[model samples]
Target: MKDSLEVLPGIELSVIHFHSERFTMHHELFSDVLEVNYCHRGRIGWDMRDGSSVFLGAGDLEIHTMDCCADSTITLPLGGYEGITVLFDMEVLEDHVPELLKDAGLNGRALLKKLCPGQTPLSLPASPEISGIFSCLFEVPQKLLPSYYRIKMLELLLYLEQLKPSHVNRLTSYQSELTVLIREIHDFITADLSKRFTIEELSKKYLINTTTLKKIFKAVYEKPIAAYMKEYRIRQAMLLLSQTDDSMADIAGQVGYVNQGKFTQAFKEQTQMLPTEYRKRCRLRKMEKE
Candidate 1:
């Protein structure tokens, strides 16, 4: 397996594979890439800007678009991870099979998340179907090509749609319940990424008991919900810096940091670089790439 960031730069497809020590990469949007991560081994976490970290275990597969500030990624291979990261263009289905997504309402934004958010990543048993489809789409292995992958992706999405909340069975384990709760937390964070939020407020709004919420949330997502929210806010702030001309103060307030100093501190802690420095670096990188 490749031990570095592998970028397959194609007009319509890209694939990356990471295997090694635990490292966090800060992606300041810019790449209109959508990633599907197949965690074959080890524990991985996506520290999204919406707080609650999304945890992917041995068999979990996650898909989401990459835009400015949409990453808080931890690629830790030592912790038992070795797998494939497939990147595909959003238009693939449209160009190849115009009616596939339209007929099934399968575009991620409109359909998938309503069906399966990072809240409950495609679980192990459910992963092969998505992974196979993604692999086929990207043609990474260059064996079966896109045909097989399309078949797999569509089949997986159909299965995913059936796993939604209303259709979920009560016999599903407590961990499953916690996973559902975590999604609710992410929903809250993403909806109001900049507001002041408290545990009590979160519980009241979601109609959950605070203690039970914390217990289950941390148990499933592996980070306190409050901490998740703060980290996510910082990540979003980074994205805003790279993509917008928003001032530091406004940016701080927008991502829920009440004070400039505190925002800077939080930003530094999560990203290892101060906000100004990060912005400068991003600008230089953007200029060089463009």
Candidate 2:
């Protein structure tokens, strides 16, 4: 779902929530626009033209011109993403600088140039100041949303203008070859949740160095192998819980947990409820709908 609001002339704010593996961006429509994206949850990977990939995880920010993402394929390695994007139409913004911004001596065009400087996007980890600004955007009273967005947008631009070059994160890109291998590895590992694979074992099997495997895997999946798999297993367990009548022990074993006690503990850790409780809740909801 995408919800857009024009907070100011030529300045639009959009809340984006997508669930899918990949999608191609039609950036041609917004050629002269500057886009600022903040990932609130999940991960997004951009397949750049230079045979490399850039990823953004929770609390990360990416700024770029629309041209930079033209025809680019965005991949959600985790199959889902939620974020906010603020688009600046450089021409309109430059032509009519808002009175509030003029009073503060803020120039939207200058800020875009400063942040972008090149065709490649600028991605940075969220500093505390940035986090504090964006967190408030997620929850605002409906009546005050427009005014709230205007204030926060202005605050964000001012804060960004003060950022030094050193404060920017060095853009990290994973080679296309490694990204492909990592995807293959992901499929292999997740193809059967009942089996567990160690880093060393996968390293030997895939002919990639263990360190490289772990680094690239984490970059693509946003978590180390074990942690990613643990979350994946639990999520799959959730689906089975909601849809099937399998015994708890059977569900645990299907997701690679041989011990019922360990499975229950992991389930509680991820969902804050035991497996049986979760299943009961699902059933109750289904019955209510019926």
Candidate 3:
């Protein structure tokens, strides 16, 4: 498990990775604040004090209003999971985004209070546009993170303001009801990356209709199962590139790619660079840090 936390004047960002470990968390909030969370990989769930629960899967995003004295128990996945969280102080929003406040006819604190009354959390409508923004946040170079964060903050606010009230309300009411089943499917798929399963086989094994499986899988994982699997393999390859001294062919095979040429092509397509170049850059970065 690895976790990094970065703190700025009015906000905090945490990028967390858990590998095959069951992590339990009990959180009791002492203040009113807004939290934006993006699930990059795997799943997480929160059991609220009110008896309601919210689960976030890979590529799913959600917001929270940590009303004073609110509490929840969090369940983390056992296979692996990665997530990013940003906490915003109400005063920070008030001091930084005056234009947004003016348009909403309230000051920052007032607007924050209105958007989330600290009762129930809201799940914003997900789109390619929103997902792409979240992806970019991770790829930005470390040196540019602070400025990039500020820019993304404003962009997020602008996008939020444009969301229709009715739509936002409806989305808040929508929950991924079959979270347990989806997580089971995810665990199976990720358990062995080298093994590829057919849709029919998966449907039979899971006892779910093929069409329903595909739809819910996409909704939860934010991509088709096949696409997600391919990306998962590529991600495994990426880690090997940075952390191992294996040859390209060996690394490719480890991640289920039998053909080095094909693996190179996919690597370039996903990262826009060759595997050797990526390894070299990683080494250089390590040397610089050392």
Candidate 4:
């Protein structure tokens, strides 16, 4: 695998840990999840697939997305490199997020990728204020501290909002028009999700080429059009399966699947579980907790 994440035992209790022996350790990908790392000392190099080396040392922080992945290797110097890793499950984040931000991230985690494109794997200290908050959040679940966990999560959100990007200059007419096109495209998909459309139609509608449209969509949404559409369909199917009386065949048709068999297959492929199995599992898990 190109990427992976590992946490050592007692890493949380200890102030520092030796990881040089794991020098070549590569982290695995967990789709839609966020991996946060903090470096305590010494540089660890990442030989990125892009042929660039990111050098991370003590006090450097890094965040990576787990959905789309690539191969990279971590090099711990002979002296040994030390760091802490925090893995946040994507579903947990959605469940815990504030209602206002339950949809799109207030500022979006994608901005974090742009700002901290760590050429290296490291988590240097953030502002002491945030460092304290992050430390609390990282340890909360481990300690079974739910109240403190919620507070820490709120603090993290506040800190993230403080990092919001500032507008550098006035918007040009071209930029304005591009913004309009983005809104139109978003609306078009939201309204006609069950229907299929291509980039060609998008290009013609916006009077721009396919490449530009794709670029803009990715920049704003951090996903390819088709991938997002599939995700949307899967989400809709999951909801219908769990909450409504709709049969699998009816649900499939509602979510743009003309073939009941094909819908079932696609749903399984995306979630790694059949719709019936998932619904049952969801209820079972909930029941077990209660």
Candidate 5:
């Protein structure tokens, strides 16, 4: 779901909630525009023009010109994302700066130069103050959304205006080749849930050094291979619990757990409920819906 509001003549705010593997973006209508994105959950990756890739995980911010993302595929490695985007139409914004922002001495062109001095996109972990401002965007009441968004937009810009270059920590960008290899490794490992592969084993099989393999995998997926698989396994187990009548042992084995005891422990750790309890809860929720 995407909700957009033109908070000002040249400033627009959008809330993006995507639950999909990939989204292709076209920038036909975008030029001389600055796009700022904040990731509230999940991970998003962008294939850059120079055969490199950048990623944004939860609590991260990405700022760049729309052209940087032109004709690019945005990959959601975790199959979901929730975020906010603010677009600044530089020409319009420069001509008609909002009175409030003008009084506060905030200029669109200046902000662009400050935040993105180069052609490459700038991505960094959001500061606590910035995160606080964004968190409030998610909870504004419907009736007050228009006014609230405008206020928050100004606040965000003003806050950013005070930041120094040294405070910005650019996120690591990986080569497309390495990212592709890591993705292949992910698919290979997740393809057969009944089997498990160690880091050393995967490294040898994929012909990548173990250090690079682990580093790139964590960068792409935002977790080490083992942690990512454990979460993936639990998510699959959730689907099985809700949709199938498989026995505990069968379900456990299906998701790579050797025994029900181990599966129950992992399930509880991930979901705070045993497999049996989780199944029962699903049934109860389904019955209530019915």
Candidate 6:
């Protein structure tokens, strides 16, 4: 891990990197600062204490308040994850640039409260300009990181404030009682890509109200449970197709599809390519590289 944390007068900037295949961590954010996370590579999942969660993939950004309790657990996928986090001190902003903060449509209070009013964490897929900044952030000299970080931080604030209010994503909060358990259910479903299970069975096993389960699952992950699973399974299948020489039947089975034809259809719908054709193209590219 080549993680670095730099603290300037009032702002703390961190560039984090992890190399594990998969890992989970319980994080308690700082109470006095607003945190902004930019996912530079891989995927990062945030399981909130209130039963809602959010996943930030590469080039995605999330802004949220800090909690004293370990209110969130982050999960990183295989090949690990890399991200940049900026912690802005609200007091510092208020004392130094109150006008600038107000101009940015923020009041220097809790970032979530100021920006989202009464909402959950704000998660947005980065626009090209923001994405380009993240992509080039680490390319600068180590000595210049602080200046670069400060510039980028200001740029991000300006960009975010300039966007239409509707374009700024604001995730919804859920009941506290459901947070951890729903996250557990999510972990269970994603733990095995090859297993198929219904919401009824999951509801029964977890003893959560079926309707509430459906609602909170969407609140946390931004998609219905079944759709999330389907997309996840398909993503795994695509990875297998491009990275391995496994037979189509085996790949399909690995991704929880027992019927090859059904898997083909799903693959086509997601990637516009049959599994075999995708594999062949991958192989051709590999051979060409050689």
The candidate maximizing lDDT is: 5
- Clashing pairs in model 3, backbone N/Cα/C closer than 3 A: none
- What candidate 5 gets wrong by more than 4 Å, as runs, is 29-31, 103-107
| Location of the lowest summed lDDT over 10 successive residues in candidate 2 | 23-32
> Which candidate achieves the best TM-score against the true structure?
5
lDDT per residue as tens, model 1, 1-290: 45322222211322335555345567665333455566655555554444434556555666555541265545342234555565544454335433454576555444434533443333233345445544344334555544454455455546544545454322112433455555567666667766776789888888888998887666454467777677768878989999999999989888887788999999999999999999999999999999
lDDT of each: 0.58, 0.85, 0.68, 0.56, 0.85, 0.71
Model 1 ranges off by over 4 Å: 1-55, 58-172, 175-178
- Higher-TM-score candidate of 1 and 4: 1
Q: Give every collision pair in model 6.
A: 51-179, 53-220
Worst 10 residues of 4 by lDDT: 5-14
Off by over 4 Å in 4: 1-176, 285-290
Taking every candidate in turn, the Cα RMSD to the unseen true structure, in Å, is: 14.8, 2.6, 7.4, 19.3, 1.9, 5.8
Q: Candidate 5: what lDDT?
A: 0.85
Task: Show the lowest summed lDDT stretch of 10 residues, model 1.
Answer: 5-14
The TM-score ranking, best first, is 5, 2, 6, 3, 1, 4
What is the lDDT for 272 in model 2?
97
Q: Residue 104 in model 1: shift from native, Å?
A: 44
Candidate 4 lDDT over residue span 139-183, tens digit each: 455456545544555555555455533422211112334534654
Q: 1-290, model 3: which lDDT tens digit per residue? A: 54444444456677777665334454566355777778777766655554555657766677766652165545564356787777777676556554534565435465455555546665554567568657787788989977777667666655555545345432322233454576678888788766778888989998988998887677555578888888888888999999999999998888777789989999999999999999999999999999
Instruction: In angstroms, give how far residue 160 of model 4 lies from its true place.
Output: 16
The digit string of per-residue lDDT tens for model 2 on 65-148 reads 787777777889989999999988878877777776786766766776677676656778867876887877878878988888
User: What's the TM-score of every candidate structure?
Assistant: 0.45, 0.87, 0.54, 0.42, 0.92, 0.62
* lDDT of model number 3: 0.68
Error of 5 at 174 (Å): 1.8
